[model samples]
Target: MILNGCAIVFDDEKYFSLSGDNVQCDQRYYITNPLTTQFHVKYKKKKEFSPKLLVLMTMSSKDVFDIYVHKGEQ
Candidate 1:
């Protein structure tokens, strides 16, 4: 998903990458909590934000993504 000017690509069940104004030109992030649809983004070790929250607030109500709930460890 692309948010603001950044591109967030979920590589798998555990990895994702961010690239844009705040993010480094080359960097990848690993999901610390994959069970919940929550994650964090840090820029230059200073600025930080939650992409999930941004999506929930900025995205229109018509826009929605499939949500999956995991009961146990994968």
Candidate 2:
């Protein structure tokens, strides 16, 4: 697996990164802006695979969401 990049932001607060391990892993989310109390995290994962296998996974909670997937040559 490879970490592409991350640009997560909520309530005027901003976060950036280029490393993450398995989208299904645990992550922490918080509200950066005081004025905004509600926020959402949207994650999208795209897997690169050979021409033989493909997989996908998506999970969400009351305040967090994650999307993962694997694909093959079209």
Candidate 3:
């Protein structure tokens, strides 16, 4: 997770459907911010089950992330 530094807050998309038939495809949630460690990745999609969707993050990284993004208005 970002070269073991970890910091991605949230980049989201999660839709829900399906009433029955036990569902569990992807789920992982962990966030401890003292030293740093963050990961909340999800992956699940169904087409025939009335179209369900969950792809919370798809990151292409260059590594090193402690959380810093305030370059101020360009």
Best by TM-score: 3
Residues 1-74 of candidate 2: C-alpha lDDT, one tens digit per residue: 24346444322222222234334545645556746553334443535531333333333322334433344343
* Alpha carbon lDDT at 51, candidate 3: 37
Clashing pairs in 3: none
Q: Candidate 3: worst 10 consecutive residues by lDDT?
A: 65-74
Please list the residue runs of candidate 1 whose C-alpha ends up more than 4 Å from where it truly belongs after superposition: 1-62
TM-score winner between 1 and 2, please give it: 2
**Candidate 1 lDDT score relative to the true structure:** 0.38
When superposed on Cα atoms, how far off is each prediction in RMSD?
19.2, 22.5, 20.9
Clashes of each: 0, 0, 0
Residue 16 of model 3 has an lDDT of 49
Model 1, 1-74: lDDT tens digits are 33666644442232222324345754666666656644345334533532221111123334535544333221
lDDT of 3 by residue, 1-74 (tens): 44586544444455544443345553344445634542222334434545343434433345433432222121
> What's the lDDT for residue 20 in model 2?
43
Off by over 4 Å in 2: 1-50, 63-71
Return the TM-score for each candidate structure: 0.16, 0.18, 0.19
Candidate numbers sorted by TM-score from highest down: 3, 2, 1
